[model samples]
Target chain A: MVDTQWPVYEVFHQQARGEPHIHVGAVHAPDAEMALVMAKEQYCRRQACVNLWVAPATAILATEYQDGDMFEHATDKSYRESWGYKTPKTIKTSDEETSK
Target chain B: MATMETLQDLDAPLKSAVIDLLYRLADDAIIIGHRGSEWTGFAPILEEDIAFSSMAQDDMGHAHAFYQMLHELGEPDPDTNVFGRKLDQWKCASLVSLSSERDWAMSLVRKYFYDVAESLRLDSLAKGTLIPLAQLARKLSSEKKYHLMHGHMWMPRLGKGTSESHQLMQHAVDTLYPHALGMFESTDADSLLDQAGVCPQENDLQQRWVAEVDKILSEATLKVSVQSSPVYGGRVGEHPDDLATLLENMQLVYNLDPSAKW
Candidate 1:
């Protein structure tokens, strides 16, 4: 059967200035202009929002949750955390005192 | 603001009239929203597809809000109000329940025509003596501005585009123009609404709408021959078959289990 339905677009909403655009929902439209109109009507009725964006679902590249290893973090990176700075702080203090 | 006492003191006739009017308004929004939703994923462009879908959702939302207001007045619950009722039980405007044939030109024309009518109607309601209705109208009116803008923007663009596009839009306008007049049909509660300052005179509203739309169409280089006789039935519950089919689809899940929490 010939496909009759339009393509679906993902909707994102920015609630206020400086806020990140969050994914709200999706709507189907034949073109981008129409999608923006539909997004405004579907997503922004009551909520206060300064901006909206709609993108084609096919355009997004998402990682699959089943392939988990790529997203894992290293547990041995303690030196990158704030606690690692404490050791350097003591060393710097001793060095400054000795130089003085 | 009129004192709450005035709103609370409505007579039986006026209350019935208000209920009748509310049903008409709510049903109009519901049916049109349903029709608009059908365009989902099928608009000519992705942006417009989202735009039309969003507009459709807004119409349904407005319907829900109106139905809630009616419920507070001792009418049926929103579920019963929208789904459980028979076709004849619906009080939407005839213009809304009519199908758009899924034609882009027709959809745009119908939307532009209806938005013009709805915006004016909502403007009148915003000034209603009834506080809650007035507040609701004001909120709806705010959103209507964008809806109207969307329609206004499309009318000229499509009407003046390519020859084929222009012809399609013109034909759509011709097809819908007669039914469009039905948007101004007066309910039996007209006098009651006017007396209570809930709505202005229909003639006044119609005249203003005509003047505004005429200006827009002229700029679009389109001339619409005004129809002498307009078809109207929604106020009294008469509707086309499409409305029945649409209601069947919309209420199928809801009707399956009226008592179940979905």
Candidate 2:
């Protein structure tokens, strides 16, 4: 008969430095301050964690699985990998040959 | 060493008594934890909701550990021990089986009262004669510290919040105080447990619980008239009607096909 329930918040946790924040779970809290505390206790009790973030679940905009392919790339983005720059190695070798 | 050997040699009566006590402990945790978990998505705040859910999980975990010990003693598996038992067969304290849902104040007050009683009981069990149970009791005692802290931190804040909040909390305390006092109900095997050094004096435990809770309530500027005639049916398996409904809900999936493994 009473409205005592609070809002739900999505919890993201970063386990260590340079790590991506992963969605661990959700918790309901009346406010942001309380949500953070609950997230720390519920999620971080067993392991190390550098940081935690709590956002209202309703605030996040998410793409549906049906539209996931809309963001896929057609180009071969080989430049993103370390092995992609084989031309640099060849150029360095040519410079050394010319110097010799 | 002699004491240790004596304790290790648990005769049939002592074994039965220990099993009985363990069932009471495990069942109390299971029922209360289940009830508390109902607040999962519905606490006063998101933080409190999460915190309460975590506490509920811890309570259930503790019950599982106790059930494991009982299983070693040739009792039913943890699942059966928890969900398969008839309503009248559950050995939890009456306080745990009270249906106080949708009432945050009552939930907190009930939890506070139960935590105090559980902490004290576990403290006594930590010094028990049985080595395995004593070890488990010690571990559980640490977990209860956080539960107590959670209740203590919130009782005052919520008790003195808005007028509506304050009224709700006070009314909850008033309603649950008697059943909360039922936490101190004397188990049938208390004499055996006392003689075997399995638990400490009940009066001393009750006094300690009262003193600790009274101090906390007084600090919060809240007053409760401690009820003398506390309800007592849980230890012997007599429960309120709410427990039947609760068990039905909990066991629904399990009961669908008991022989089928999910």
Candidate 3:
């Protein structure tokens, strides 16, 4: 079968002004204008939406799933943690040092 | 004159004219909505598929609003008025009922023309003396604002896009322009609607529509001939055979079980 669909566009919409535009969904369109219209109909029509944006799916730079483990924490890094610095409340006194 | 806020404000002839206007409004919305929805799965692209389908839903909702208004004036419920009516009883303009050969250009032009007319009429009603229609028009215009936007987005793109596309769009306009003009075909209620201070006659609406359409089409590099005769008779319920076929699909489920709550 032939692949007859247009390019995909990632959709982001904001529920209010000065708010973040969260990723709502994607649509297939020839250009950003149609993509914006599509994003509106597909994602914003039924919801409380104040604004929308559409970018070509090809324009997105994404990490591979196989590289997902690269985001995990490295071992032997506990020194940076707050628990690593935890200690009893003790003062270093000259008397204690002399006794030692 | 004061606004006619309810059905009681209408005398016998005035009520008849009002119902006539309502039927035309509701019928046009329903048929074009049905036609637009045929592109649901088959549009050239998925986004447009969603767009057309979305507009179709809006049109249907508008139709429902008109039907509900008619019900307030003693017509049947929306479903029965839509599904139970015979082919000859339909008052939709021929432009809306005309079948497409799965042509996107035809669909776009038809919707563009109809929606523009709808928006203009809604504006007239929104400011008219029929208080209920005015209220409904004001409410529906918000949704219609986007629909007109969609038309603006596509008309120029397809008209100036490619040679073939431009020609296809031109052909679509030239072919459908007459039918579109038919949308304002004179009806018995035109005089009454005017006398009732609802709005000007349909021909005046048609003139404004043509001017608006002309300006937009010029911007899009498309043209419609003034010499083309308007296809009439839809206002009086004479439609092409396609309406019956379209209705068969539209009312298929309803015809199966009119008693069903769905």
Candidate 4:
């Protein structure tokens, strides 16, 4: 039994109320309760923690790391960023628009 | 029974009994804390290594709290009392000092047994009539819950695992049950403490502990021989050579620089 290592659970830690549960680390445990125990001890020993969440590593879906180019846009996609809306547009009345 | 609200309320005999009780609690924590700390680099899994180390720190902190209480009762400071004591001076049961030799099953069994007893002891002390001790016990009682949770999680998993694991857990339970009984080894202080409404009799607590632990053992599919007699000695300052060696190793670093501050 050199390699009967238990399943890994991805640990998520919430620092405080209204904060997102960020992926802290992973721990091997037989189940979720044990995973929580392991995750708290391993990931939150020195950090401020309000709560924790653990899901089996298998449950988390992710894009392949080799597909990095999928996230890189060949064209600029400034519409996705708040900075692209920095300028206020001038509103013209219907009459002004017709005169123009 | 008069309530001891403060140190001044303790008479001579009661003070002695209280000191005896404190030594039992403090020394057991110190010894078992060392045992848990030994698993720092050797646990079956990395998660367990960290968990055991964390428990070790909690045990040491509980020990320090008890020793502080002892110091208030006219004993030495916490550090001096814990680190300067010899083997026989320590009142920890031999169970905590039992040689695990890096056996994971043995260590888990020892910790599970000790945490059960410690939880029961803290609960009783917390509900007792001694104001100061009850306060400390109530605080320590909260931390014992996590240790008990750890114990509950692992015991059943190992016991109901493969056949070899089943055998390993059974062996550990059979081997350590008697020593666990040694945890409740009674003394003259029992009567004194009982009379003062401070804590229950050791035997009473042991019966309740057995009943409670029996359910978990059942779930673990392990049977304990109830007829096993306790190997009692540590309560009265009698101990094996292992304790001396443990104390020596535990104090070696401090001895290297007696005058240096951490």
- The numbered model that scores best in DockQ is 4
Instruction: Point out the worst 10-residue segment of candidate 3 chain B by lDDT.
Output: B43-52
TM-score for candidate 1 (chain B): 0.94
Clash pairs, model 2 backbone:
A28-B46, A29-B45, A29-B46, A29-B47, A30-B45, A30-B46
Per-candidate DockQ versus the true complex? 0.16, 0.20, 0.33, 0.38
Docking class of 2: incorrect
Writing each residue's lDDT as its tens digit, candidate 3 over B1-262 gives 7788777888899899989999999999988998988888898866678778988999999999999989988999888999899998989999999998799999999999999999999999999998888999999999999999899889999999999999999999999999999999999899988988887799999999999999889999998787889999898979988988998888898888889885
TM-scores for chain B, listed for all candidates: 0.94, 0.94, 0.97, 0.96
lDDT of each residue in B1-262, candidate 1, tens digit only = 3423344566788788888888878888888888899999887665567677888888999999989988888889998878788888988766677777878888888888888988988887877787778788899987788888788777887778789988998887677777777777787788877887777766677788889888888877777875546778767778889788888888898888988875
Error of 2 at A10 (Å): 15
Tens-digit lDDT track for model 2 on A1-100?
2454778889999999899999999887666766776787878878788899999999999889999888997899888998887667888899999999
lDDT per residue for candidate 1 within A1-100, as digits (tens), equals 1343878889999999999999999987666776777788678867989999999999999889898887777577778789865556888899999999
Q: What C-alpha lDDT values do all the predictions have?
A: 0.81, 0.82, 0.90, 0.89
List candidate 4 stretches off by more than 4 Å: A1-3, A69-100, B1-3, B253-262
- When sorted by lDDT, best at the front, the candidate numbers are 3, 4, 2, 1
TM-score of chain A of 2: 0.65
In angstroms, give how far residue B231 of model 3 lies from its true place: 0.5
Interface RMSD of each: 5.9, 4.8, 3.1, 2.6
Task: Please provide, for model 3 over A3-99, each residue's C-alpha lDDT reduced to its tens digit, 9 standing for 90 to 100.
Answer: 5477888999999999999998888777888878778888987889998888899999999999999999878788988898756446546557778
